[model samples]
Target chain A: MGVEGVEPHYQIVVTRDGSLDNIEVQVEVSEQIFSDEVKSLEKLGKRLQTEIKDLLGISCRIKLVEPKTIQRSEGKAKRVIDNRKI
Target chain B: MKVKQIAIFLENKSGRLADISHTLAANAINIRALSLADTADFGILRLVVSETEKAQQVLKSAGFTVGITEVLAVEVPDKPGALDLVLQVVSKAGLNVEYMYAFTRKSGETGMLLFRFDDQERAIKAFQDAGCKLLSDEEVHAL
Candidate 1:
């Protein structure tokens, strides 16, 4: 998921709850746009969470990050890292 | 003067912080000052430590997202309005403080405040020109 200037790459991580839990989306944003602006990123992240929940009908938590901080691949970008416990 | 601060990306899970501290401690890296900023999922643990490069390597090898940021360290008298005055000067100079944190040394005579500004040079000039007592890198690390 991405906005105009803020591009987000995400990973799916398991929730803390044991029995039943909503999906969690860990988003890595492009640093060129957000830099370290936490407030702005928080706002954008909330909007993204709302939009995702509405579109997919599956509620999930959003975690924002910087792009280079996340691992990259050679050919196709490895967007989502599945950390969800099976 | 600028001080090197290490920012570690920590997942919001039990024992994450403990694991980091233990890793550093086991490697003989002393943490001088630290601040943890977090959301529900993850936390950013910023630290002023004894050795920058070694600490970075240790943390990275331990599988943590580590980054180094140059921050200004200002020593202010441990009293009321000391920090407010510094902020006022920064605001008056039209500088933005990205983030800031405070720590006290063992001496207790003065307090150290770590400030991150978008423009490092501008902030340094503003604070210096305003005659705010700033700490050198050596001074900060020694503390």
Candidate 2:
């Protein structure tokens, strides 16, 4: 298994009645997940949506937000979400 | 007039549905109305249950990706176009239904419908305006 750790996805769907209207599915990752050129989560959202549609045959709107703040201490770095307020 | 439904993404594999059932059973949650949305590689388990909070916790703790959704428990006579009627409303509203499945009831006079739209909140409002009965969280829990 290519178990390179796991990233958690919190999918929020804004549906009217039982029909899907606009979907906002997001995944939150630590700061390190945002590499050098990837400045925003929009890229991730597009990637996931395409993947989902290809897999499910249902198109959905998605939003991914990865706010990674961390300081390397001991053996691991703790990513924080505090940077979004500014 | 609305029911709280939980949709859990299930990997398509042997015993997947049974696993969900066992997990819910372990927590003493009883299912009321349920339907399944499926693709080739995966499936979504839409369940209306007696205990939402407990069921939510059970599913999350089990590491199954889940979502809380609003679904229409519309009833129709066991006849053709009964389903088409709902579809018509959805189409009229310019809403694209991602998926839907039909269910038969124990009474044998009615067929229960479960569906998902692009926008759930609007879909609910539209159906209610059109006089479709929506099951609430309490109503689903009681059953």
Candidate 3:
């Protein structure tokens, strides 16, 4: 989510499978302005996955979505979508 | 010369590409050349259109995330070993090619190759020194 002059939109989707909990980070990255020269979208996803693991101590999957694809709440932003309850 | 290429972000859902093409067609934008690089979840569609600015504007208005990138358009002879000659120059110059795609004209002995280099300035210089013919934005649009 390293975009300049524009706010990066993202949403965290948490789910559970049997006994393990999984987290998925969806980031909006359309422009080719990555400082590290990430050529492909897959490589950018991998880099963001590594960063999220380092910061949260929980390995998660990265999903690169189009800008503004994530829904925005009116008052309080609902950044995390918990699908584990379902 | 540098050519303006439109890069679009697309989801991996079906009919997304069709939607983009339909949008462009409805707006009278002609896609001259294009390439798609994708992951499991998303894809980047790079296109050289007849009108870069108009295409970008229309695509954005149509709700597609679009960005314009400057890529080198080299004219390569339409024969064996021609591509190798250009690659040789890039290799000798220590230039890193991020991605490249080829497109041919209906009636021409030379095909066009669009290259996105890590170092644009160095790549341009290398191609120029190697006596390669680069297409300008106007040339690409006309094609």
Candidate 4:
């Protein structure tokens, strides 16, 4: 979901009233980064789901959306904007 | 003269940065400066901080692969050729720069830098002797 020279960030959105929400994942990478990582992101999502539920002890049904591109930040990208239950 | 930054080995994926950042945030550890060296499937999360030892412990306790390294934080301008100048200085000292990334934070006039060299101790000595203004651990952490 990220291109080369870019960092990837994801938005975790949860609606109390059951509305389709847009959780933005900004991945800043090079142009060549997107061709790969699509499948792996899906797998990574599954792994995160398990880890979050187990370690953090949170049980919230989440959905995986397509990865989006983000403008490159110099260093240390601010990822994981959790709008869910905020 | 020289400072250590934690280099965390991570398989590139979603939530990887989140996992570390969230943990650090939860522990009241602030990231002073950081970068990630990413290959195809793996990346090294490098960070300078006020508390290097504690940050490494927190990260390891969370099951992260962590390494402590001495990196050179050179303060250069944010303009073009600033990197070139640093390279030239390092090269003049007969040092091979393994990698470098722009700093995450900056003062009003000076920008910070993170550099990995083939030989950090020698490079630091040379850079400092050459008046390269090697940032102290406190300087890098203040970033």
Query: Predictions ranked by DockQ, top down?
Result: 3, 1, 2, 4
Question: In candidate 2, what are the lDDT values of residues A1-86, reduced to their tens digit?
Answer: 11122254343445443443555454544333332112223354456677778887777665433222112357643322222222
Q: Is the docking of candidate 2 incorrect, acceptable, medium or high quality?
A: incorrect
* TM-score of every candidate: 0.71, 0.57, 0.86, 0.58
Write candidate 1's Cα lDDT for B1-143 as tens digits.
89998887666678889999999999999999998887766677889999998998998888776777788999888888988999999999999888999977645578889999889899989999999988988988886
Model 4 scores a TM of 0.58
How does chain A of every candidate compare to the true chain A by TM-score? 0.67, 0.48, 0.77, 0.37
lDDT of 3 by residue, B1-143 (tens): 89998888888989999999999999999889989987677778889999999998998888787888899999988888878999999999999898899977744588888999989999999999989998898998998
* Residue A17 CA displacement from its true place in model 2, Å: 46
lDDT of 4 by residue, A1-86 (tens): 22232334544444444554444332222222322223443455455566567876675443432224333357865445556553
Q: For model 4, what is the alpha-carbon lDDT of residue A80?
A: 52
Off by over 4 Å in 1: A1-23, A27-61, A64-86, B106-108
lDDT of 4 by residue, B1-143 (tens): 77788877566578988999999999999887777766555566778877999998998788665668787788876676777777787888898766666763554467777777778888988877777777888777765
Error of 4 at A63 (Å): 28
**Each prediction's DockQ against the real complex:** 0.17, 0.04, 0.41, 0.02
Q: Pick the candidate with the highest TM-score.
A: 3
Alpha-carbon lDDT of model 1: 0.78
Clashes of 2: 26
lDDT of 3 by residue, A1-86 (tens): 34342336688999999988899988876544322123555666777777667777779988877667788889888889899965
